[model samples]
Every structure is written in C-alpha cells, then in structure tokens.
Target chain A: AQSVAQPEDQVNVAEGNPLTVKCTYSVSGNPYLFWYVQYPNRGLQFLLKYITGDNLVKGSYGFEAEFNKSQTSFHLKKPSALVSDSALYFCAVRDVRSGGYNKLIFGAGTRLAVHP
Target chain B: NAGVTQTPKFRILKIGQSMTLQCTQDMNHNYMYWYRQDPGMGLKLIYYSVGAGITDKGEVPNGYNVSRSTTEDFPLRLELAAPSQTSVYFCASSYPEGGVETQYFGPGTRLLVL
Candidate 1:
C-alpha cells in the first residue's frame, strides 16, 4: 500500500531560524509527493509537489521541499521561520494505480510551532 | 473565481440524524472530492467524482455517499450520523491542467455528532 509518514509529531523553532519538517513515503513505481498546510479552523492549502524532475521544489509562502529519492523523503524547509508559519503540515503520496485522477494517501500530520 | 466553497461552516447533530454537506466549485473542475480530518491524523478520502455521473469510492467511504450531477457541484451525504463521524469535512476540486493537477480546497465544515 502507498503511504507517507511524518516522523515528528511537532517541531519547534524560533522566529527567523531555519526549520525542517520531515516526511518519508513508500510507494510503488515513481512517487508523486505533495505537501499541505492547515491553519487552525481552516482547510488545507497546497504547498508544493514533487512529480519528476528537480529534487528541490519551491512552493507558496516562502516554502520549499527537497525530494530525496534515495532516502524516500520529501522534507519541507524554510530559510527563516515566522510565528504565522505555525500550523499543521501533512505529507501525501499519490496512488497511481487508481483510475483517472489518482487519490492521495496522507501521513499523520506534524505540528510546526514557530515561537517569536 | 470563488475556487471551492463548502456550506455550513459548523454543524452539530444528534446521533442517527442525517444531513448533506454542499460543495460547489466555480472553477469548472472536472474532479471533486470529499474528505474527513481528525486530530493528529491526516485527511481521509471519503468519496470522489471524476465528472458528472462518475463517482467512485475512496479510502474511507463506509458511512458517506456522494453524487456529481453537474460539473460544479459535488455534495456529500451522511446517512445515520454517528459520534465517530464527527470531523472537519473538507471539499476539494481540481482541474487536470497540464502536468500539475493541484487540488484546491474549501474552508472546511466542522461537524459534531452527539
């Protein structure tokens, strides 16, 4: 079964410090990875995706993720964290076997807290 | 465009009651989906529709039903709601445009069953 795993339940970092949220996935064939962030009482917002090329992918709100195929990881990163960046982050992988539009299998989310 | 919208920002229901969560996307997306999110756990796909009249079961489709009668509307129905069904329900739509098929989501609906 295709799945994604977020090893950390919560990650804390000081404002203006670099932050990393770890994610690892297991899937057959090529992996299509995605990152989504959810704020309190709100729906998820797409951050970025790793389809084929470019190990490092940039996304919305000054976020970027590096796709490490050998490590089976796609960790989200930011150069400088902000208090507003604190939220729940999820990592997902697409199940390619599904017909038409593939469905996503998500990991247990990780909460990121950026302290001011 | 309003992207995707879900009605009833918050709702509380007694066990055994039923309700329909309305979701509409003005983006003319060909695909729509319904998911339930619980604390700590990531979202679970309840149902999805590829197009009008084309519906399919997803990872977690046991207690939910959906119908896609039009390209813009895909409503999720819960029959005989239970306490376990209490969750934040999110509706999302996506257009398979080019290589990037990004799913745009709505501000979720919080459902609580007593």
Candidate 2:
C-alpha cells in the first residue's frame, strides 16, 4: 500500500507568484513520484522524479513537476516565487513492493510560504 | 562524497536511556535508510538496508533498532527512550540507477525524549 498525499498544510506564495505544491499518490504499479525540499534545519533536498517520460518533471532550484496520470497527481511547480523559495515540501511514493529496497512513502508536509 | 552522514547532531534522552544513531555513506550506496521526522508526520521508515549484512523493517519500526555491517555504515538503535521518541532523524543513501533511485540525505538527528 504505497501512499502519499500532501493536501497542503501551508502554501502562500507572493514574490513573483506562481507556485503550487500538492501531490497525491497511491501505488500498485506504475507510480514513482518524488519531490523533496526542507530547510529550517536542513536535511532533504532532491526535487524531482517521476520515473517514466514526459510528464513535466524538471527539478532542482527552479523546480518543476507535473506527472498527472489521470489525477494520481504529482504537482510541485514554480514560475517565480523566491524569498529563498520558502521550504518544507515533500511528496514521495515508491514502495515497489519493498523488496527492491527503495522503500519511501511520505507526504504529510507542505509548508511553503514565499512571501516577500 | 559524504553523501550521507548523521551522528549526535542533538540529543536529550531520558525515559529509559539508550542511544545509537549514527549513519555514514560515502556513496557506495546499495541502499540505506532510517527516517523519522515528525512535525507534520512526513517521513517515517525506521530502518532499511540492502547491502552489508542486510536489514529491514520500516514504516516506523517500533522503538527502532538497526545495523548493517558496512557498506559505509547504518546504525540506529534506541532501546527504550520514550516521550514518543522525540523526532527528526534522517539518514539516506541510494544506488540502483536507471530503474530509478535518488535517496541521498542526512543533515538531521535531533532526538529529544525526556
């Protein structure tokens, strides 16, 4: 039961606008989305993944994410927002049955307030 | 490439006193994980390993306990310490490219059970 659902605990953008952080996932087969970024004390920083092809996915500083295979979602984008790009935003889903050892199933974080 | 490294960054146990949270990874990464970040409950997977001696149990492994002979390192063992076992503790490492894998993380360790 791979799960991940960051409905939004906080997300208030301002600096240049355009920012979204909302993910949804529940795997069974074909689903490996991820996007992490934390700051306030450090740890977690890898902002892109959508294992497949062309569903938008482009990570790192500028950030990007799309992969919406009929609403199984994966959305973390940024058009301008700055203010150090806020922080705390995680959404992961990769249990692949757990035998592969790549276990990850998180998503209860989304505090990105980039107001400047 | 320190890639993953964790130690006592901060601690304050008491309840039943017991500790051992140290992780290391120079990148050889066959896999390695141990997570626990509670604020909004984002991360949770108390143990993992796919190399060295091999280990398992994740998704909040009861009070926690782990080990991996050496693929770098992987240690997490908290015998009793309660208070819900504080929070913030992460250590990650990855390998297995192509099939997709990108774990790499470790700048955390802030247990506080008192």
Candidate 3:
C-alpha cells in the first residue's frame, strides 16, 4: 500500500515571496506523484505530476514540484506567490508498480495562505 | 462544455434521510469517481465506475452506494445520512487505459447532515 503525508497543515507566505508545501510518500516502488489545488467552493484543479523521467515537473499556473527519489519527497514550490494561490493544496501518489494497482492515494492536504 | 455536472450544489439532510447525488460528464470519459472532501483531510474516494453498470467501492464506501447506468451518468446514494457524512462531495471524470490523463472535477456539492 502507498501513502502520502503533507507535514504542514497551513503555510503562510507574502506575495512576491517564495512558497513551499511539503509532501512525502511511502510506496513499494517508484510512484507517480501529483499536485492539485482547490479554491473555496471549487473542485480540485490539477497542477503537476511526475510519472517518469525528469525529477522537476511543471504544471498549470506557474507551479512546480520536485521529485526526490532518495528522500521519497515531492515538494510543491513557486517562486512568486500570489493571493490567488491562496487555496488548499494536495499531494497524491499512485503506485502502478504495486502488482496492477493503479488507484491514487492522497495526502491530508496543505492549506496555503498567500497574502498581499 | 460542461466537463462534469453535479446536481444539488448544496443540500441539508436530516439524520437518517436518504438522498442521491447525481453526476454526469459530457466528455464521454470512461472512468467516473465520487470523492468527499473534509477539512484537513484530502479527498477520499467513495466509489468509482469504469463503464456502464459497473461500480466499485473506494477508500471509504461504508454508507454510500453508486450506479453507472450510462456512460455519462454516475450517481451516488446515501442511504442513512449522518453528521459524519457532512462534507463537500466532488465528482470527477477521467479517461481510462492506464495513461495519465488528468481528471476533470465538478464544482462540488456541499452536503450537511444534522
């Protein structure tokens, strides 16, 4: 079984500053990682994902995440924060290598507060 | 285009009441899923359907039932509503076959049971 952990419940950052939402995972083998953002009253929007190749993956709205195999972490990062980015972020993993299981397992989610 | 449509954006149900949450997707995706979002907890999959007339339980499917009568429609049913079931329900659809196509989500239906 695979699981994800978002260590931070909430992360506060001023606009124009860098921000990071921590995420770690435990899986039997190489895992597929994903990041999603959810605004108030809205469903989650896909941000980025790491399937194979490149350790650094970029996705919608100027967001990116780093996949560290040695550490089993996939941390979401943005160079410049915006108030619009103030929302709930989630980290998910799918271990396709786990004997034909392809379901996604998600973290508890990190609430981001980007202030102006 | 209506990517994913969920009926009754907000609903308040009394304890033990039964209701169904309707979901449809125009994308003709083969896979549909129902997930509930609670505060601090990410989305927990309640049920999923890959094709018509095929449904399966997810991470949390204790009091929920679902049916996929058609390719576009997947409805979630709550037989006995409880306060523990009060959460934001989201419907999502994605293409199947192992490739990593993104899952499109509906606006969400907020349900409160008291």
Candidate 4:
C-alpha cells in the first residue's frame, strides 16, 4: 500500500521567513510524489511533483520540495512566506510497482499559516 | 478550456434521499476520478475511470456509485444519503502518459446530508 504522512497538522511562519511543511511517504518500488494546495472553498491545485528527477523540485507560487530518498520524505519549502500563502497543503504518493489504474493516495493534510 | 467542472456547488440531502453529482471535463483526458474531502482528513478516492465504459472502485466506494459513459463525463450517484456522507466532493481528470499523470481538479461540490 502506498501512503503519505504529514506530521504537522498546522505550521505557522512569519512573513518573509522560510516555511517548511513536512511530508513523508511509504511505497514499494519508485515513488511518484506530488504536492497540492487548496484555498478556502476551492479545489486542490497542483504545486509540483517528483518523478524520477533531481532531488530538489520547484513548483508553482514560489514553492519547492526536496525529495529525500533516505529519509523517505518530501517536504514543501518556500524561502519567503506571504500572508496569502495560508492554505491547506497535501502530499500524495503513488507506487509504480503497485500497478492497476495508478491511483494516488493522499495524506491527512497540513494547514499552513503565514503570519504577517 | 473548462478543464474540469462539477455541478451543484452546494447541496443538502435528507436521510435516505439520493442525488447525483455531475462532473465533466474538456481536456479529453483518459483518466477521471472522484474524491471526497472530510474536515481533517484529506481527499479520499471514491471512484475512478480509465476511459469510457470502464469504472472501478477506489479506496472508499461504499454507498456511492459512479459511471463513465462518455469520455467527458463521470457522474457519481449516492444511493442513500447519511450524515456521514456530508463532505466536499471533487472531480479531477488527467492524461496518463509515460507513467506520469498530472490531475486537473474541479472547483468541488459541497454536499451536506441532514
């Protein structure tokens, strides 16, 4: 079974400070990891994905994530946080070995709050 | 391109009542999915289709049914509404090419079961 875990329920960061939202995954074979952000009353928007590439992957809205294989983690990062960056972040994973439709399994989600 | 769109932005259903959540995509993607988001829990896959006339159950498919009769539409039907069924539903579409798929999501449908 492929699954992802977001250890933090909520993360608070000051404006202009670096923000990090932790995420870890468990999957068989290679893992396809993805990060999505959802605002109030809106569907999730794709941020970035790690599909057999460099360790560090950059995404939309000045966000990036580091895919650490040894740590089994893919943590979302932003150098400068903005008040408008407050939203719900989700981490999803799909195990390439576990074929058949290739559905994604998402984490419980982490709420990020960037204080001004 | 509309990408993905779900109808009935908000709906209230009573116990034992039933309703169908409509979803349509203009991307002509071969893959479509339905997910439900709870308060604290993230999105849970309810159903998915690889192409027209082919549908499969996802992680959580109880009390819910889905059909993919056309490439552009995938509708989810709830047989009997319950309080536990109250959640936000999202429809997404994607084209799986070379083993990498990027799903495009709809605005979502907020369903409240009383």
Candidate 5:
C-alpha cells in the first residue's frame, strides 16, 4: 500500500526565516510525491511534485522540496517565510502500479504558522 | 477553463437526510476524484472514476456513492447522512497524459450533518 507520513502536526516559523515541512512515503515502485496547501475554508492548491530525475524540485511561491530516494522522503522547504504562506500542508504519494490517476494517499497534514 | 467546479459551497443537513454534491470539470480530464477532509485528517479519497461509466472505491467510500455518466460531471451522493459524514468535500480532476498528473481541485463543499 502506498502511504505518506507527515511527522509534524504543526510547524512554527518566523517571518524571513526558512521553513521545512517534513514528509516521507512508502511505495512499491518509483514514487510520485506531491505537496498541496490548503487555506481555511478553501480548496487545496498544488505546490510541488517529485516524479523523477532531479533531487531538488522548485515550485510555486519560491518553495522547493528535496526528494531523497534512499530515505524515501520529500520534504518541502522555503528559504523565506511569508505570513500569507501559513496554511495546512499535505504530502501525497502514488505507486506506479496505480495505473491511471493513482488515487492520491495524503498524510494527516501539517499546519504552518508564520509569525511576523 | 473553469478547472473544476462544485456546487453548494456550504450546507447543513439533518440526520438521515440525503443530498448530492455536484461536481463538473471542463478540462476533459479522464480521471475524477471525490475526497473528504476532516478537522485533522488531510484528505481521504471517498470515490473515484477513471472514465465515464467506471467508478471505484477509495480509502473511504462508505456513505458515499458516485456516478460518472459523462466525462465532465462526477456527482457524489450521500444517502442517510449522519454526523460522522460531516466534513469538507472536494472534487478533483486530472488528465491521464504525462505531466498532467497534478489534480486540479474545486473550491470544495462544506457539509455539516446534525
């Protein structure tokens, strides 16, 4: 079974500081990892994904994630935190055998609190 | 392209009452999914369709039924609603082609069962 684990329930960060939301996955074959952000009373927004190739992937809002195959992790990171960036983050993974549109298995999510 | 659109942004239902959450996507995406989000839980796929006339159960499909009669519409039906069914429901769509794996989500429907 493909699953994603988000270790932190909430992450506190100060403005202008770097932020990291940890995520790990378990998959049968090559992993397709993705990050999504959701604001209060709103739908989820796509952030970034790691399919293959590069270890470091950049996404919207100057956010990036490092995909570590050995550790089976894809942790989202941002150099500078913005108050508007505070939201709930979800980590998802899909197995290769999922065939089409592998139903994304999401983590419990990590709430980000950016204080100015 | 309107991406994905869902109706009834918010609704309050009485226990045992039934309702349908409408979802439509204009992207011609072959895959559509229905997921529920709780207070702490991120998102759980309730049901999904690979294409028209084909549907499958996800991690949580109980109390929910979905039909994909057309490529553009995927409606989720909630029968015999209960308090446990209260949550935010999301409709998502994605293309089967490579690089289109990213699912575009709708604004979501917040349901409260009493």
Candidate 6:
C-alpha cells in the first residue's frame, strides 16, 4: 500500500516570508511523489513531482519540493510567500512496484494561508 | 485542448436518487480516473479506466460505478444517492507511457446529497 501524510491541517505565513508544508509517505518500492494545489472551488493543479534523479524538484508558480529519501518525506516549499498562494495543498504518492493502472494515494491536505 | 471536462458543475440529490457524472477529455490519454474530495479529507479514488472498455475500482468504490465506452468519455454513476456521497468529484486523465505521468484534472463537479 502507498500512502501520503500531511501532518499539519493548516500552515500560516506572512507575505514575503518562506513557507513550507510538510509531507511524508509510505511505499513499498521507489516512490513517485507529487504535489498539487487547489484553489477555492477549483480542481487540483499540478505542482511538482519526484520520480527520480534530483532530490529537489521545481514546479509551477515558484513552488518547489525536496524529496528526502532517507526521511521518507517530500515537503513543498517556496522562497517567498504571496497572499495569492493561499490555497489547499496535497501530497500524493504512487508505488512503482505496483503494476499498470496504479492509482495515486493522497494525503489529507494542508491549507496554506499567506497573510498580506 | 480543453483538457479534461466534466458536466453538471453542481447538483443536489435526494436520497435514493441516481445520477451520472459525465467526463470527457481531449488529451487522448489512455488512463482516466474519478476521485472524490471531501471537506478536509483530500481526494479518494472511486474508479478508473485504463482504456476504452476497461474499468476498475479504486480505494473507495462503494456507491459509484463507471463505464468507458470511448477513449474520450468516462461517466461515473451513482446508483443510490446518499448523504455519504456528497463531495466534490474530479475527473482526470493521464498518458502513462511505461513511466510515471502527470494527471490532468477537470474543474470538478460538486454533488450534495440530502
């Protein structure tokens, strides 16, 4: 079974300050991790993914995530937060060992509030 | 490309009523999926289709059914609507070519069961 966890229900940060949303995962084999952001009444938009190679992955809207294999974590980060960045963030994981048609397992999600 | 599209942006249903959520994608992806998002529970997969004429259940497939008769369309059916089925339903598609692929999502359909 592949599962992801976002420990924090909400994260608060002031505009221009760095922001981080923590995510951890459990997978049997190599993990394919991804981050998505959902605005109010909107579907989730892809942020970034960690398949292999670099530990750090850059994504849309100046968002990035670091994949810590040893720690089994993929935490989303931004150098400077913007009020517009306030939204719901989710972390998903897929087990590579699973054969075709493997569905992604998502975390409970974290609400990011960037105060202006 | 219109990407993934879902019809009936919002719907209200009474108990025992049935409805089908329509989803279509122009990306020509081989994999399509249906997921439900609750208030604070993130997303849970209800069903998926790897290709036309092939469908399978996901983590939470209790009250939902799906069919994929064409590559572009995959409709999810709710047999007996109940309060537990109220949530935001999302349709997504991806072209997984032997490796990991990104899933493109639709705006989502909000369903409220009374």
* Reference-based TM-score, model 5: 0.95
Q: How many backbone clashes are present in model 1?
A: 0
Cα lDDT of model 4 by residue, A1-116, tens digit: 56799999999999999999999999887789999999999889999999886999999999999999999999999999999999999999975653556578899999999998
TM-scores vs. true structure, each candidate: 0.97, 0.33, 0.94, 0.96, 0.95, 0.96
- Candidate by candidate, in order, the iRMS in Å equals 1.2, 8.6, 2.0, 1.0, 1.4, 1.1
lDDT of each: 0.92, 0.88, 0.88, 0.92, 0.91, 0.92
Worst 10 residues of 5 chain B by lDDT: B95-104
TM-score comparison, 1 vs 5, better candidate: 1
lDDT of 3 by residue, B43-75 (tens): 888888878998888889999999998999999
Report the Cα RMSD per candidate: 1.0, 13.9, 1.8, 1.3, 1.4, 1.3
For model 1, how does the per-residue alpha-carbon lDDT over B1-114 read when each residue is reduced to its tens digit? Answer: 888999999999999999999999999889899999988898899999989999999889998999999999999999999999999999999876447577889999999999
Ten contiguous residues minimizing lDDT sum, candidate 2 chain B: B95-104
Worst 10 residues of 1 chain A by lDDT: A94-103
TM-score of chain B of each: 0.97, 0.33, 0.95, 0.97, 0.96, 0.96
Deviation of model 5 at B21, angstroms = 0.3
Error of 4 at B100 (Å): 0.6
Error of 6 at A23 (Å): 0.3
**Candidate 3 overall lDDT versus native:** 0.88
Q: DockQ for each candidate?
A: 0.77, 0.35, 0.63, 0.80, 0.75, 0.79
Top model number, TM-score = 1
Residue pairs of candidate 6 with colliding backbone atoms: none
lDDT of 6 by residue, B59-86 (tens): 7999999999999999999999999999
Per-residue lDDT of candidate 5, residues A2-111 (tens digit): 67899999999999999999999998888889999998878899898888789999999999999999999999999999999999999998756667566688999999
Interface RMSD of candidate number 2 = 8.6
Q: Over 4 Å off in model 2, which ranges? A: A1-14, A17-29, A32-65, A68-75, A78-85, A99-115, B1-11, B14-16, B19-34, B37-44, B47-56, B59-77, B80-109, B112-114
